[model samples]
Target: MSTRGNPWAVYRRLLSYARPHLGVYLLGVLGMMLYAATEAGLAGLVKFFARGTFLKHDPTVLWLIPVAVVGLFLLRGLGDFTSNYFPGWVGRRVIKQLRQEVFSHYLRLPTSFLDGQQSGHLLSKLTYNTEMVSAAATNASVSLIRDSLSVIVLLVYLFYLNWRLAFFCIAAAPPIGWLMQVANRSFRRYSTRIQNSMGDITRVAKEAIDAHRLIKIFNAEEHQSERFERVNEANRASNMKLVFASALSNPVVQLITSFALAGVLYVSERQVFAHRLPIDVFFGFFAAAMMVPPHLRRLVNISGPLQQGIAAGESVFEILDQAPENRGGGLPIERARGEIEFRNVCFDYAGGKGPVLQDLSFRVQAGETVAIVGRSGSGKTTLASLLPRFYDVSGGAVLLDGHDVREYRLEDLRAQVSLVSQEVVLFNDTIRNNIAFNAAGKTDAEILEAARAANVIEFVAQQPLGLASPLADRGQNLSGGQRQRISIARALLKDSPVLILDEATAALDNESERRVQQELALLMRGRTTLVIAHRLSTVENADRIIVLDRGRIVETGTHQQLLAADGLYAALHGMQFNA
Candidate 1:
């Protein structure tokens, strides 16, 4: 939904987050009322000062006026303090609540949804957009409520003093409102552009930072800098449009106010000379009239933040509105028998792309090893991704232990499979913690065993802290093989019935590959293992091999059988050794 079409709709939703702090919010409103009343009180005090001190010149009135002035100021100070402090308290609470909800929603968003989004844009929404929402929901609201009340109270005072002059002051109201409406439209439009521009800026900056090594190697520093400047300049330009709208609005509104004020002063002067208006009464009326314009101006100026916030709220709510990843069916299982089947599977990505895998069917028996070999676009990884339910097939079923994989609860189903791919992921934690990542209840002995089996103990022993030693970001301190072994250790600790090794040692050197291969063989024991490898020699011992070409399985047999048949598998095998 477009927030611009129904701004109050977005604004009201934003305000709901502040409901938990309603008591504090009410206190702030009350303070605003007190502050507003004091403005009228100040005008009243002017009349009292003029009448008693100038006209009567009484000694008692002189003494009381000074005390009244001090008392009035003290109340104003208290009111200002209450209004400022209490709303700030509520705003912070709203921010905390909103941030948490957005963060939680991010975790549940479908993988497909995440695939289509940039990390920088998501991060911007978490930090920057949430702040804008708080400002719109609470900070802008404070100004709108406080300034409106101040204008109302001061106008009522003017009417009480003299009905004619008060009516004249409101003559500017209609045109001012129209002008503000126009400015508000401009603000919201540009605000949305500014938000998108900020996301672009974040996207560029993050890309440059993460790929600094790539940038340096390619001598592309100038290219990245230019990309950043483009986004940065766009953000500034969008902001300037908002600034131009805000800047033009106040002065034009003030000019309209000035004309009305001129009219009031012209009429009041004539009435005073005619003896219809008293000097003290005129002072009070004029004082109240003068106060209305500033408050009115602020009421118009508040549209900037108010509309900007609405735009921000729309961005945040869009994420919250997305459907989460599908929850699997009610079947429960502690473990699977490791039998798997893909019955007539057909799958494709979004945007009407042709199928990545089509009419593909396969099976692996319990404790048997199968390998899938293919060219770059032959759907090898895609086949493995489907087994984990990363993407549901367009037309087929993936069965485990004679039931559709979807019949088991997602957590229960995922618990039965482990994967170690070429792109090994490690956190900035100790070696022991990395191995025991998802094995929360495992004892220390189990963790140690997994680490030792995966060859992690060899290099870890060089560190002073051994298994407890902290790694750098993404385990950058470790060699390629070290990172791969940690991943293998994690998979080992899991010890699930099904294992997928997606080129697990593809990035390692000859020595690293040999050492890792030994551990992988140990990992493969008594499990339904599916290996996707580019290197044909790695899968030579598999019970069976499936060769894919253009989303179809063109050949399937044991290594020797495929070699005897001399088809796609034999050709691919020849090409690899030839290289």
Candidate 2:
């Protein structure tokens, strides 16, 4: 859905975050009430001052006025503290809770959802949009409540001083309210557009940063700059629309209030001069009427942030409402024997972009090693992905240990498999932690043993920090071989019954590949392994190799048998050797 959701509903839902801290929120409301009363009381004091000095002629009135002024301001300061501190406290809490929930939900969302979203846009919602929500929930909300109450109290005081004049002063209310309604609609529309444009800006900037190497190599600086400028300009233009509305609203409301004030002053003067109104009452009504303008101005100004916040809330709630990844059935497995079968499987990505795999059937008995060889786009990776249920088959079923993979709990199913892909993902963390990632109850000795098996200890031991050394982001601090070995170490630590290696040695040089292959051989021992390889040499020792063309497996047999048959496998091996 678009971010321009119903403002009232968005705001109401946003307020619900404060429900857990209602006691503090109510205390803030009480503080605002106390502050509002003091403002009205200050207006009333004007009448008392006039009467005590000019009418009553009492000497003690001088001391009473100064003392009361001090007392009033002192109480007002306390009220201000309570109102600012408590609501701000609740607002910060709301921001934290909302941020946490959105981030956690992101982790559970389907792979399809993640693939369709730009990471930058998600980050913007987490950081920038959430800040906007807090501004509306706290600052705008508090100003709205406090200033509105102040306006009401001041109007009541004016009515008490002179009912007829007060009635004339509020005659412009309906028209001003109507004008504010128009401004609010404009505010919300522009605010939604501004937020979306901000996301675009973030998306472009992040892409440029992440792909800096590509842009530089391709001499595309000007291209990236142009793209950034487009989104940046759009963001600025959207903000200007909100600015124009907000700027115009305040002046118009002020003009309307001025007209009402002029009428009040004209009527009050004539009444007092004609001896129909008391002098003190006339002054008190004037003081109370004057207080309304500042409060009105605040109420007008707050609408911009309030509406922007509502728009932000709409964006945040959209993600929160999304269906999470399907976690499959109730059956759970601590471990599986890892006999895997793909039964007449067919698969397609979203939008029905034709089948990537069709009528593909294969099985690997427990503790067997099978290599899948194919040209690019031959569905090799897609077939392996099915084992972990990254994308379910469009038809047919995948089974693990004679049980449909769909009938096993997603977590339990994934726990039985380890994947090592060409792109090794390592967090910016210590080598030890990366190897032991979330593998609960693994002793340091076990961790070290896995590192040794994966050949990670050889390089790690040469460093002063050993396994404690921290890697840079995506393991940029290490060579491709080192990163690959660290990934293998992770898989070794997992020690699952099944493993899938998709060009795991593709990036390494020959020497490093040889070293890593030795470790991979150890990792594959006695485990059901599916290896997707482009290099024929890498899979020559497999018990069997399946040759795929397009989405179909054209041949399956031992390497020598496939070569003797002179089919697709022989053609692939010939091409690799010729290259």
Candidate 3:
């Protein structure tokens, strides 16, 4: 369903998430029925009091009335407890299921979709927006259900006493409903703005937290504070607008209800004075009429949360409704032979931009180490990304082992490849777990072996916990060389037949780079490795090198062959070495 569709539609979808806990929800409904029963019971007691105290003048009446009042209140308290408890129980479960589904959807969404969305905004929907939905689903729902029943039952009691007075109050409902409808529209608009402002606040705060070192080094604390202030003020202003609307709505509704009550008083007084109505029946009717206004006020107040929830739920449903990445065909392979080819491949980010790679053709023979050297933005990284199908080519096909890669199951295809990039991503976990991440079947003996090969054992032996030592976030506890080595160990543990090393040694010191290069050479053995690098020296030992410029191969040969030609490669090499 379109998120922009009717809000009632979005509301129904939110209710459906609560369907699995229907048995618990029904218990809450029974509580509401009990609460509604008290409304009629109170009106009946008033009539009995008027008769017993005024006309019967019985000596037994005083004690009996107080006991009946106490009994009625005790039952009401029990009703209140069940009504709040059971629905609250169901509300929490709904939130859990919603968060789980949304987070799972986040994991499966396409990379392209994620690229277009803000992480902070999405996070707000997961946390802030979901909480707003809970208030609407549970608290507001309780008021709507119990109070609506109260109003209906009280109105019925009023009609039983005297139909004319009940009819006059019913006439006032249309205008109150009109005012509520106006308030609902204002509430929805402000609620959507509040959610967006909250996203902006989260975004700014996250950016500052992630870049604390940068901000401190640049002395930009004041700048960041100003940025945060803008979003924070925006959120405050939006909330105030909702407050204004809510404040205005309640009194105006009461004012209209007051007018209805006054008119009923004027009409009923004449009937009582003319002896057309008894004082007891008039007292009972007035008591029931007084009860209806509070229910109407509560009903009006509930519109704000109800609309806020609808807006929040619509945003959440938008994420849940998105199309996940295609899982690809069913063709299965335990291990690929690692023959990769690009057949006149062309690609755009497909985000209203020109193609990044245009009609590019390339091949890597089984177990061959081919290095791609390029200047920045020359599509070297884009070319490497296509092999793993992080993106499908817009105009051509990427093939593996004489079959289109799209014909293979996505998981099975990715299983044959391993990646180690300059920006190493390590979770805050044990050193052993970082290397063994997603390497489901590897034995502990093999993990130690991969660690040793990648030079991670050099540092692990120095630590007290050895492989069990925990790393800081993004492995900040480790040096550049140490972090790169752990990533290499992770890639090495995977043992995939195809490997893409994207400037893996680019960020390290010269001594560290040299040491990592030794590990790289060891890891490259028996695997079809595609090495992307800017430094010409690293690719010199490769069996073949492809020099890329503007998304096309400008030179392809052995390193000496390109140097002898005195072209882009020779010039690039001369600039690095001769300078």
lDDT per residue for candidate 3 within 1-579, as digits (tens), equals: 676657899889999999989999999989988988888888888888887888789777799888988898788888889999999999999888999999999999988899899999999999999998998999989999999999988988888888988889998989998998998898999999999999999989988998989999999999999999999999999999999999998899999999999899999998888999887788888888888988899899998899988899999999999999889899998898999898999888966468788887888899999999988888988888887888888988999898899999999999899999999999989999999998879999999999999999999999999999999777888999999999999999999999999999999989999999999999999999999999878899888999888887888899989989889998889889977
lDDT (0-100) at residue 195 of candidate 2?
85
Candidate 2 lDDT at 157 equals: 85
Off by over 4 Å in 2: 1-4
Clashing pairs in 2: none
Which is better, 1 or 3, measured by lDDT? 3
Q: In angstroms, give how far residue 546 of model 1 lies from its true place.
A: 0.9
- For model 3, the stretches where C-alpha displacement exceeds 4 angstroms are none
Q: After superposition, how far is residue 400 of candidate 2 from its true place, in Å?
A: 0.6
- Per-candidate TM equals 0.97, 0.97, 0.97
Task: Evaluate all candidate structures by whole-model CA lDDT and list the values in order.
Answer: 0.89, 0.90, 0.90
Give the range of the ten consecutive residues with the poorest summed lDDT in model 1. 1-10
Q: Show the colliding residue pairs in model 1.
A: none
lDDT of 1 by residue, 1-579 (tens): 444357787877877878888899899889899999999999998888777777777788767888988998898998888888898898888888889999999987877688899999999998888888778767688899999999989988988899998888989989988988898888889988989998998899899988989999999999999999999999999999988888888889889999999999999999999999888898888888888888888888889998888898888888888888787999999999999998999989875478899999998898899999989878998889888788788898999998998898988999999999999998878888888996789999999999999989999998999999998987988999999989998998999999999988889998999989999999999899999898888899999999988899999999999999999888888888888
CA displacement after TM-score superposition, residue 302 of candidate 1 (Å): 1.4
